[model samples]
Target: MAPNRREKGNTVSDSDPHFSGGGVAADGFDRFGTLPDCLLVSILSLLPIEDAVRTSVLSTRWRRLWTLAPLRLLDDSALRSEKFPNKKLLAFRAFHDEEQWRTQEGWRVRAIDGVLSAHAGPIRSCRLSRVYFHIPLLDGWIQTLSQKGVQDLAILIPMEKRFYLVHPSLIACQSLQSLELCYCRILKPTQPRPNLVNLRVLNLKRSLVTDAAINDLLSCCPALQSLALVHCAGLRRIHLRSPTLCIMMLDDYSWEVEELFVVDAPNLEHLMLGKNTTRRTHVKVLNAPKLELLGFLDMSIKMLQLGSTTCFEKSMVTLSTVVHSLKKLAIRVDFNDDLQADIVFDLLRCFPCLETLDVLIADMDDDDEPDVEYWKQQVSLDCLDHHLKSVTLKGFLGQRTDSGFVNFLIAKARVLKVMTLISVHAWKEGWVETVQQGLCLQNKASIDATVVFMKEKHEINQFQPWSSLF
Candidate 1:
């Protein structure tokens, strides 16, 4: 049998407001009134657009509340579905008769037009996702938004059958602060945007903008603080004039790195240059005053003109001036063993004040590993910075060069605390023993630093492993 419970209109406790000792009134739910408009808007803004719009049907109080909150404009073409409605699609195709097709197309255009026009006010953020439109409609909407003053705009122009072009009026946004354009095809050359003075961050990732267009865009964004260009293929020589830009990330390796001139960037802190899939034919130099952090892979001989007298001479001249003031340095070597060692020495000598060094060796061929005693005596690690505290050698396979560098670090870096050796290939049987010999020779009395011999990236091996080496 079920225990006895309170029935409708019955209350047990008088102390609690919810429980009216003897009997409770049905009107108890009507105690709270509408919240402040600002608070309600904040709550609604956190909801998804579909759910936010659903608030309009909630009650009389919420009818127009959603419109008062922030609006996120979405394009219909950006939507993706797992399955298609075959029946509905067939029905739509059947309406290819002139009048019906015209009617359907007209309604579709009008719906989108209405959505965009409705939110033509002071918007906090606007996202135009994969939207395609003719010049007239695009211009009209952008001009309207510019007049209304939008703060953030994210335009992701996808490459598809439909023609998508950026309207010149969009760049004239007076109140725009943050703008992102991804995967956009440049249909025509655009006039630089001088009016977007308040723009803080500009990201053009995988954009079809030409080098000239990039320069023009950078010229307009004088107050931009952070700039990112990933696979913007046309960008060659970058000339940054923004005194406010402190952080930069350029990830296109195909473009010849022209001299980067950062003018009056007092606050510039970090600069990251990623690998170029295609070789950079020309030498690139960076000039910045306050740039303390730099992340760039050392260019290979093939990437450089190192083999030739002209390229080697050029590298020798530039490498000295590259990291003169840098406090931390990272060098990635991918070349012949003898050439790599020589370059490594030359590169290390550049960073006089380098405190931390991360060295990665890639594509070590089978023939590169020679007789241990013979190669060990030949390989040398000299002129390492005294201030170097941490050394990391990635893609380590216990080669003489690898052991030689470790041995050098163990001897030279007096203040060294940690040394890490990561093997991309499988762990050699005696790899640990060889590493231990280097560490033991460094006066076993000195602080025994942490040395890690790790074997990762084995699954990435394409060919059969060489069993003799292991």
Candidate 2:
């Protein structure tokens, strides 16, 4: 027996018209079906196009609900299931395997296009990466979306390697708050006044666009809050000067980028640079007073300039310059040789006000310790004594070089509160004892410090809070 639920209009009994063996609602009846139409439509809008359309078969009440909801389509491409190191390589191979994937892709495109045509409500978001990016088809779809008022749009084709000039409809979509494009090209704006004033987030990865195009885009996007250019080609120099921007990530590892200069970004906060993938020789932050999080600074940077005066060149590694605005920093270093201790210590000295330090270690074949004297000769850094509170060492294997750096931190960082050691799953038997001996935790300088050892990547992502922005 079940209880009868009463509403202003009617009552819901156990005999509700739900198929047998279906999910039991909270009230043991069709309570979910009683939610207001607006909420139900909103829920439907978030689902994949296929799943959203399937809801119509439930009953007459849900038959037309999908048409009243926003349409959202994504690129659930088969190739994306496997994590390829390089996306450009996938694009090159797509041509050879075109016939094998054509049949499935053709069906997918037709279904998406039909759904777009059938939708009677607003178009909130669309990501057409898996489908063929024929210019005429894309323009037609975008024309419909512009009329339906799409807010977020991502037109990415991983199989496209050559540059195709983005249709003017993409830039003219006045309703867009976020725009992301990959494997396409954006030419210099020909319009007298391009209309992307409402866009708040823009990400262009693995695309081809000139500096003039970038400058024009930025000039038009007065409300953009976040911007990312990852592995983009044709950028020789970058000088950011934005008033509304807050977060900017520039990863120029795929090609040679000569310089990156942050001329003026008054409200800027997070800045993510390239790691080992970078050949960016010179980096300078002329004015970004609100900057807090900065990461993956290449250890081999040729020139680093901050504010007006102090310049630290790779020619003089012994000298240091401070960046007081940056609270969190990430550095990439490798220990192929027996000695990486000197450079690490010197680099840490440059950030006196750093509160959290993330050290990314590259895996090397050799694990033997030839000399540990280089670690002992280094003097204590200002960050180690007072400011540094947390340290995260990624790819920790407890090698002599790894241990030496951990030992240096444990012995020097007097105000340290937490130290997380992330193992890359390379530890052998008796690893606990080996780490204990290697780190010398018993002789820690900061009595309040606590150490945590994590082996999984899922746990590591929790600390990376801003990864979702890009």
> Who wins the TM-score comparison?
2
lDDT against the true structure, per candidate, is: 0.56, 0.72
Q: What C-alpha lDDT does candidate 1 achieve relative to the native structure?
A: 0.56
Which pairs of residues have clashing backbones in candidate 2? none
Supply the TM-score for candidate 1: 0.70
Model 1 Cα shift for residue 409 (angstroms) = 2.3
Give the per-residue lDDT digits (tens) of candidate 2, residues 164-260.
6677877888999998888888877897456898999999988887788888888888998999987788877778888988998877444666777
Once all C-alphas are superposed, what RMSD does model 2 give against the true structure? Answer: 7.7
Superposed on all Cα atoms, the candidates' RMSDs to the truth, in angstroms, are 9.5, 7.7
Compose the digit string of candidate 1's lDDT tens values, residues 260-333.
Answer: 44544556666655533213434333446566555454545334321121224214444435444555555556
Off by over 4 Å in 2: 1-43, 51-65, 73-103, 131-135, 277-279, 308-313, 316-321, 334-343, 362-371, 397-402, 423-426, 452-470
Angstrom error of the Cα, residue 185, model 1: value is: 4.0
TM-scores, one per candidate:
0.70, 0.77
